[model samples]
Structures are given as C-alpha cells and as structure tokens.
Target: MTTDTQTQPSSDPRYPVGRFHKPQTIDAVAIETGLKTLEELPRKLRNAVADLNDAQLATPYREGGWTVRQTVHHVADSHMNAYIRMKLALTEDAPVIRTYEEALWAELSDGKNAPLEWSLQLLEALHSRWVMMLRSLDDKQWQRTFVHPEHGPVSLQTGLLMYDWHSRHHLAHITSLRQAKGW
Candidate 1:
C-alpha cells in the first residue's frame, strides 16, 4: 500500500496528500522512504513558498484556513513536537506523550505572523537532528513505543510515517493553492 504522498487526488484541500493511515506493517523500505521524505521536506517547502510576496504569503491557502505564512510556521511547530515525542519514546518506557491543541497553537502570535525564514531555518536544523537520531536507531529502538493522551500507544515506526505524511500534507496545501491561484 502507498503512503499518503502516493495517494490519488482527493477533494479536500485540507488533506492534499490524503489523510494518514497507519500501515499494517512498516518494513525496512517503508522506513527508508519515510526518512527520505523527512529529509526532503524543508527543501520542498522552501521552494514552494520562495516566490511569494508578503500579500501572497498572507493569503489563505483556502477559505477560512491558515495563510501560506501560517502553514509554513505550523509545519515547523508540528515537526518539532514530533521530534521531541520520538526522543521521549526512545528514552522512556511507553512514555505518555503530551498532546497540544494544534489549531490553537496555529492561532498563536508566532504562528500567525512570524517570518517564514525563521520557520524554514527551524525545519532545516530540526530535521537534520531528527534524521541523525532516526539513522542511529537499530531495529529494537525503532520498535520503541510512546503513549499519546489521544491515541494510546504508538510505535516509533508509526510516528515516522505519520510525520512523513504530515510534511507532504502541508506542502501540498501551499502547492495546490499556488496552482489554483496561478501564483
């Protein structure tokens, strides 16, 4: 089965890559592909927004949705949480991970108005560290689990794939808007 990045088109703009569905079993190739996706996300995202002006950046990707600026910042925010959660899972036994209201976080000042450069830089640095940690893990470590307050126990493998989908999902938001608006 394909990951969200490979899914067929959907009508929902909010889920351009399609929604993430945890794979029944994550094999070595799936893990490798996920790692590659994680590594490419910052570059892909940067290219997606590089040509936009302040007005374009401030334009919402969809009606009643986050502006392109907010989407860029949100990816950094969300991925940072994923990285920390992975660390917590690796270091503790079934650590109960904290969950935040992402919509609320997106509405915060930094998410709404921060320069895209700040978040872009954060994604580069964060993904570099995150990929380093992911590469260092052995089979046993990959199987480590973390409990989320909302989703119960989740394996490191699942988390990796989820974030891979997440990276594409938001990037698609920007690209699709660019296509629709001819930006």
Candidate 2:
C-alpha cells in the first residue's frame, strides 16, 4: 500500500499538480459520467502503462525529467491522499487538509531511483483501493467537503474526478514519451 505523502511538481502549466478544484456537487456526478470515465480508464490505460519494459519505465522524458516510475508513484500518492480526504470529510467536520511541496517531494532519491515494478504494483493496488472506495460512497459521502489551504473548500466528488483525470493525464505522458522515442 502506498502512502499519500508523495507528489510531483507539474512543469506543465495546464495540469498543475496538487491543486484542488471544486466539484460540481454529488448530485451532479451524473451516473453516466462516472461510469463512462471508469469504463474507459482500464481499457485505455492498461496497455499504455503495462506494456513497458523496465528500461522504458526508467526513461525520463528529458534530461532532467521524471521517469515513468515517478509519474506512477505520483499517481498512487495523489490518489491515496484523495481517499484519505474522503474518509476525513465523512467522519469529521470539513478539515483543513495538509499541503506539501510537490517539487521537493519528486526530487527525492526515492522518486528518482524507484523501480518501475514498484510503481506498477503501487498503481494496481492503489487503483483497486480507489475504485472500491469510490463505489462505496453514499450520497452524503460523495458530497463531503474538505477545506484545502490553497484552493478553499472542495467536494469529495470533485477529488474523484481529479483522480480519474490524473490517470488519463499520466497515461498520456507515458504514451507520448514512448512515441517520441519511437518505441
């Protein structure tokens, strides 16, 4: 099981990491939207992420960039945080969540040197846990709120969407890198 402590800084401005976005409310999570996102995720991302060899996973996007391993680790970390946030919101009052420096976290040796196998295993387990958690949400749990230090109050439902997007986002990054290398 991965901890929620890891995160990566986004050099890509469009996907600023660790930022909170308000969710449209539990009533708005439209069953179709969640189901559609859920159905597409494994089908779309499995081959992109799973087919890589160890060397491919270790390949950094650029000279100073994070490898695929770090990206997946970031995913596990971020989702783990999301799950915890949901739990907290359901059990306690709107809690002010903790914040960390993503850049600093990703720069750690573990982030740079972690094996691809470690990250892949983390992803498999993390996604399993996340899906189970999301599926178990009641209407109230889905609407639970968390007070983010930077982004203010955001709903648990939005956090789920963020993770869904996160899965696709990093899958795209890895697939793009593979294409660039003509692998």
Please give the range of 10 consecutive residues that has the lowest summed lDDT in model 1: 1-10
Q: Give per-residue CA lDDT, model 1, range 1-183, as digits (tens).
A: 344335556799878877888877888888898899999999999999997999999999989999999899889989999999999999889999888888899899999888999999999999999999999999999999999888899999889998988888899999999999998
* True lDDT of residue 159, candidate 1: 94
Model 2: per-residue lDDT, tens digit, 52-92?
78788788755676777777667656656776887788788
Candidates' TM-scores? Answer: 0.96, 0.73
Which segments of model 2 are wrong by more than 4 Å? 1-32, 35-46, 51-55, 62-64
Q: What RMSD does each model have against the real structure?
A: 1.5, 7.0
lDDT of each: 0.90, 0.65
- Give the candidate number with the greatest lDDT: 1
Instruction: Give the TM-score (vs. native) of candidate 1.
Output: 0.96
Off by over 4 Å in 1: 1-6
